[model samples]
Target: MTESLHIVCPHCHTTNRVRADQLASDPSCGSCKQALFTGHPAALDEAAFDKHISRSQIPVLVDFWAPWCGPCRQMAPAYEQACAQLEPRVRLVKVDTEAVPNLGARYAIRSIPTLALFKNGREVARQAGAMGAADIVRWVQAHSA
Candidate 1:
């Protein structure tokens, strides 16, 4: 039997079962017919955040940030590049603390530009700082490995 993975659709929040080996082939969602991985971080609200973090079989990396934070803005491009390089193996998401204050409070996020890595519905690693794309990739790989 082929192994499968549950991938939450970034566009419609639908859960999809995809063959593990096919993740890099650019799968599409069954419900919305949208590309499952768009090579960019998904912007998530509280509800969507909970769904993806809890339901996805793959590890999730969330960047908790706000619109007005200079460090957050400065790191946006690096984060985007990291997403492109990290997808299929990981799901990268962005939560705007200003829009979803409840999520930030729920996670006890004390700083903007916090990177939290979740696996099996729990946080496994967290970092509070701005990093370049290479550093972001290295840090995530180090933690996830």
Candidate 2:
């Protein structure tokens, strides 16, 4: 049997099982009928964030940021670009720390724009700064299992 990956949909938040090798083919959700990876980062609240981080088989790169933070605003474009580059292999997501302070506290996020890489429900790597698209992609590729 081919290995399968559990991907949570960005549109409907339903878990879809996709063939590991067929990820490049662009799969759609059975429930939502939306493309599994839309080349854009999913904006998730605490509940949605928990579902994604805990259930997804792929690595999840989270941008923990607040709306009022200048560096967070500066890094938005680069993060979105990185999301497009890393999709299908990694699930890129954004969490507005101001709106979801509990999540930031739970994750121990001390900075405004912190990038955390999580796989199999556990964080594996973290970076605290604003980085270019290339740097974000490279960092995720280097650290993600």
Candidate 3:
């Protein structure tokens, strides 16, 4: 049998088993039946963020954004594209800084659309402002395996 990996559902937070080699393929949660990576950013609240960041075995890339931020709005599609491309290897999460000021303050996010890379609940790197999909993919590749 191929080695199985533990992946937490971005929506339901239920842990599911997936083949390590089939990460790029569409994997669904056994219980929730939701696609593991849907090429869209996961909307994460403070509690969800804490759980995912602390528990996810794979690297997580979080986008800190606000609704009124023009740059963030413009970059949403690009971020989603990156999420599609970097699937299974890296999980994309989005935090609404306006709604969750504590998370924004904790991460010291001064700009909208700040991309933060986390591993084992600790931040490895962060980038501010909007970036193209290619640039975002490169960044994720650089920081994650």
Candidate 4:
């Protein structure tokens, strides 16, 4: 039998049980049927971000970025690659710093492309700057369960 875990829907806040192995295939929410990971980060706002970070059973990796930032744009593809590799194991997310300035200030983000790892409703580790897919995976693996 395959192990299954609950993933909170980013859209509707519904919880869905997803088999461990089907994560990379872009699992959808049972209720909304929305693609869980579309190979890109889900743009999370303040309320959704709070709920996701606090209640999600899986580890969440958030990319804090701004649209006008050159480095942030450059690192987008690498983040997507990491999502493809780390899906199910990690929930890939993105927060637009411009839209949610409070979150960026709360996190004390000093640079674009800041990645924060959250598990069990708390931040365990964080890194600044762009990293390749494998490097991102290694960073999360080292810091999270």
TM-score of each: 0.98, 0.97, 0.91, 0.86
Residue 142 in candidate 1 has what lDDT?
A: 95
Better of 1 and 4 by TM-score: 1
Q: Point out the higher-scoring one by lDDT: 1 or 3.
A: 1
Q: Model 2 off-target regions past 4 Å?
A: none
lDDT (Cα atoms) of all candidates against the true structure: 0.96, 0.94, 0.89, 0.87
Q: 49-141 in candidate 3: lDDT tens per residue? A: 888888887889999999999999999999989988887788899999999999999988988889999987789989998999999999888
lDDT of 4 by residue, 32-115 (tens): 989766666688888889888987889999999999999889888888899878876788999999999999999899998899
Which has the better lDDT: candidate 3, or candidate 4?
A: 3
**Off by more than 4 A, model 1:** none
Ranking by lDDT: 1, 2, 3, 4
**Tens digit per residue, CA lDDT, model 2, 1-145:** 8999999999888999999998989999999899999999999998899999999999999999998899999999999999889998999999999899999999899987999999999999999999999999999999984
| Per-residue accuracy of model 1 over 1-145 as CA lDDT, tens digit each | 8899999999999999999999999999999999999999999998899999989999999999999999999999999999999998999999999999999999999988999999989999999999999999999999987
| Clash count for each candidate, listed in order shown | 0, 0, 0, 0
Q: Sort every candidate by TM-score, greatest first.
A: 1, 2, 3, 4
Q: Ten consecutive residues with minimal summed lDDT in candidate 4?
A: 35-44
TM-score for model 4?
0.86
Give model 2's TM-score versus the native structure: 0.97
Task: Give me the candidate number with maximum lDDT.
Answer: 1
* Candidate 1 local lDDT, residue 137: 96
